[model samples]
Target chain A: MAPIKNGRHLFNEVPVGYPVPGKTTVYDESETIDLETVPLNGGILIKALSFSIDPYMRGKMRAPTKKSYSPPYAIGEPLNNHAVGLVLRSENPSFKAGDHVWAFLPFQEYVVQTNVAHVKLLENKENIPWSNYVGAAGMPGQTAYLGWKIFSKAKKGETVFVTTGAGPVGSIVAQLAKLGGLKVIASAGSDEKVEFMKKIGVDVAFNYKTTDTVKVLEEHGPIDIYWDNVGGATLEAALDAANPYARFIECGMISQYNQTSPYGVKNLMNIVGKRLSINGFIVSDHMTPENAKDFYDTIPAMIAKGELVFLEDKKYGLDKVGEAILDVQSGKNHGKSVIVVAEE
Target chain B: MAPIKNGRHLFNEVPVGYPVPGKTTVYDESETIDLETVPLNGGILIKALSFSIDPYMRGKMRAPTKKSYSPPYAIGEPLNNHAVGLVLRSENPSFKAGDHVWAFLPFQEYVVQTNVAHVKLLENKENIPWSNYVGAAGMPGQTAYLGWKIFSKAKKGETVFVTTGAGPVGSIVAQLAKLGGLKVIASAGSDEKVEFMKKIGVDVAFNYKTTDTVKVLEEHGPIDIYWDNVGGATLEAALDAANPYARFIECGMISQYNQTSPYGVKNLMNIVGKRLSINGFIVSDHMTPENAKDFYDTIPAMIAKGELVFLEDKKYGLDKVGEAILDVQSGKNHGKSVIVVAEE
Candidate 1:
């Protein structure tokens, strides 16, 4: 066994609005150490297979503040994210060579995972692809599942309006609502994404960039539930279109995230007359182990049976991590954005 | 009997921002009639005792549109409100002469109640004063009761922030929250109201006119529940200071009701990260007969035991209805504003 070089992406500076490529630079730090030389301390050495790029990461790129849901990514430190990896070595004996695992790890070619709490060994009994863990069957999928179960609870036969229907969490939410017998209305930024939404069984899908969302909602909705992903004008549109006793699930406010001054929602008075309930939540706080089990027990089976479809916009190599994040931020990703760092 | 000349206030025009004195005018509509000449049509002829002037009436004074919680007052008709009265003559079998009743009747010296459904025979069995029915024991009391039961549901020991702490609905909500074992923090426009709140067992009371509500909240809270009466900047302040899983009860937005442009709520993004729930409700919709029973069963007893105190800002004469409404709007009323149409 010989020493191997590891490539990682480090957070260099706090971003003002949208993060650029220069904010983070690719760094390759080489050290020669194999599995045999690794000390046993309930940790595992692994090669990163794939990582997820999500809108929430943008919150972390801001200057370190207590207000954000997650801690700010420290400058000069490797940006960590949900990733799938192959465990080359394990000191704890719970994991071994060639074992596929999922953990919150950085954008690095190779790494030693010391926190046994975050690292979980994958069963792979059904031979589900490793990259799927970072996209569909992982955090995003769990997020979609719990969001419906806890926040929105958009009932069967009710009309649901979802924003950013092409994004990771929103797309999953839209599809699940469809599967649960809801009348799914979705909005996307591009015609291609609208078409994709339509293909995914959305009852009505519109390109928000080219259409007035309020008009679209008025035509297609008296929405019973609004699953908010992009929360500026779309939120106001939803407020205008909400029916009596409507429920609004506040997921992410991607539209307001980059702006210095957030869009002031003006139609909140409707909440009074219409008896609307607006609830915001972070999936990380709500998703328990039991919830994860419930998700894994049903969703993966549905995926294998073709009853559920998950799309991943795959980007290859560690160097493309910055670009992948920008794609998510700009709503350019066709579906869940994934950076494939290494081949299985 | 000689022709009983009746003086009543009529809604003359749609108010733009706030209802002015001239938007409604007192009219003397004299008609020759007697108790025997009153046609038997399930109705009761009554002499008015007292009637309420509420903040919600401001919303009704707006242009005739379907957007508000209630219908706009018909321009030429007398303005109707919750009133306590003495039944002078009765054609309906349910009511008889000398019986005291409460009904949604016009602001007049005398009236014939044709609609039997909206009238309820007063059961002042506890020897409760009839004028009290027009204030704390009536609509405003019911509004406060239902607001807490359905919307806020502030748990025992949780800190609850209430706006308009000296007004009708808010004052009752604050008192009830205290009785329910909550730490009550309240805001009022005047220092006198602040003192009133402090006297009513509020843990902390601040004059919002002189203080920053957000700063007050930051000092005393990570508020678990916010019972909003005055919306706008105070509502925005509540949003900023809400704790995780906080509940916001949107009872009224009196602050924005008269504004040409509503204040934009800017901190709504916090709803997601903090997992806060904001629910708006119309008390009329939630106050069912069963709810009224629950309220009457407990609240009246609490009042009798000196455990509860209700303040009434009573003005004499039907001609003063407009002035009373203005007082409620300007936050000049010490408590629930009531017009004594005639002496009981």
Candidate 2:
């Protein structure tokens, strides 16, 4: 073990409505950390390679609260998310040095993971890039798969409407729905993102910023299912467009995530007449053995066969993390936003 | 059969926000009609004894649109609902004169039913009143039974929150939940209604007008299940008060039915973190033979044992129908609002 210079950003204070520019800060050289400690029993010491920046992180940035699904980042501590890394040292018998692992870790150059369950060695059998573990084919892809498979129960010949269709989870959901013989309608913030959704074989793609969701649905509904990633107005539109016995899968409310006062969903009365079912879920709850097996077996095959496509908006270094988060929060990214912490 | 003077009320026009005084009009010197005229071979001529005035009629009063669950009342046609009657004449082999039957008919003194399926012979076991068919022991009772049996799946020792607790459907839902060994919390519009809910074995009851729903929930929350008969603010509070994996049975949105613009539920983001499932259904969709059998076999037994109680606010004649509707809409009725169109 030896002292190593570790540069990292830490969460300073809770944001009011949106993250302030100084909410996250990269330390000066004088504050560099020493990575001299050995990993605890069943633990691995790793160098961070890449990190995911998602809309859900905005909820965590609020003053630490128990109401959030995941634990909030402690003030003055580095924020954490799904990350891909290279193992520099291992105190666990199951893993060794040079192992490429995936774990829930912070945005730091190096770290010691004491929980073995949170860490997994990456298997690159098809020569897939390591960063894919943090984007599609990883947490996001599995999430899309499980939500579609379990919640939506999308059937062949059925029509589906997906909001935030260009984001990591929504994009995967659209592709999976298309592959399942469903007619897919997708909505995104920007025209570029809308084009990307159409490129991925969505039956209909619209820029929600320019197009009225209810108007689009008036022509195309009554939709059989609505895969909701962005709630609020989009959800109200979906509620209006839904057919009898329609299923609404609530995955994320990115539309309301940063608002000081979240939008109230009107037209919920339609639920009764339409016999609608709105179910909300977190990805971690659906990571069963069967779902994991299906995710690992089916998704990569779809990718290799060109039947599925995923986009990654990657920034060059850890210093760009805060800006990357801002880009995601503002819906500037066309796909999964990731920060490349170090070169492989 | 001879011509008889028949007095009835007809739907004149759709209401803008709430029904105006003349939204429905009673006939001045009603037309006399011959009962001999039969539209179809299988027909039963009946005298309407009693009719139900329910909240769902508000939707029917909207500008006749195909979007609503039930068909709108034709501008000049008599409004229809569940009514008990005496069969005056019959050409159908399934019925005979002097038989008491229930059917979806109008508020007139008499009518002809060509469809046998829409009418059922009433069973008077344990000397249950015939009008009870339109109240606690009939459609509303069956609805409460099925919603709880299918949606809530409430376990003993769990807690349930019911909105509109003094209404026919809401009252039954609270009692059923209590009988199933769950602590029941109910909300109503008036102090008298709150007292009624408490008398019906509700563990906690509140007047929603004076007490803030969210504040009440903040004290007694993390509720297990919310049986929503009144949506809007109460639904928002339920969303906030929901514990992990809470189920919300969407029965009715009485508060929003008449509004030109419905209330927007604000705390929907909590659905994702809490993993809540909000489901809606029309009772007709769930009236299986098994459910009907259970309702007939169990509910009457509970009533006989004094384990269940139901109230009916019965107006004397069809002339009182409009006032009864307004009472139900304004949350003034202490129980199920019904019109005794003819004396027993």
DockQ of each: 0.77, 0.82
Q: Estimate each model's TM-score.
A: 0.95, 0.96
Candidate 1 residue pairs in clash (backbone atoms < 3 Å): A3-A32
Instruction: Pick out the ten consecutive residues of candidate 1 chain A with the lowest summed lDDT.
Output: A24-33
- B-chain TM-score, candidate 1: 0.95
Tens digits of per-residue lDDT, candidate 1, B263-301, equal 888778888888888888887786678987888787767
Candidate 2 C-alpha lDDT tens digits along B135-209? 887778878888998999799999899998888898889988887899888899999999999899999899989
| Highest-scoring model, TM-score | 2
- Candidate 2, residue A176: Cα displacement in angstroms equals 0.9
Fnat by candidate, in order? 0.80, 0.86
For model 1, the superposed segments whose C-alpha errors exceed 4 Å read: A24-33, A124-126, B24-33
User: Is model 2 an incorrect, acceptable, medium or high docking prediction?
Assistant: high
The reply for model 2, stretches above 4 Å from the true place, is A24-42, B27-29, B34-40
lDDT tens per residue, model 2, A276-300: 9989999889887787777878776
Q: What tens digits encode model 1's per-residue C-alpha lDDT throughout A1-344?
A: 66666778888877777778755544446444565676657788888999989888988887675566688888888898999999888876788889988899987878887877878888866566778787778888888878888877667899999888877677788889998899999999999988888988999999998998888888999999999988887898899999988999998889987888888887788888788889898888876789877887877777777776768899998778888887888888888889898878
**Roughly what TM-score does model 2 have, to 2 decimal places?**
0.96
lDDT of 1 at A116: 74
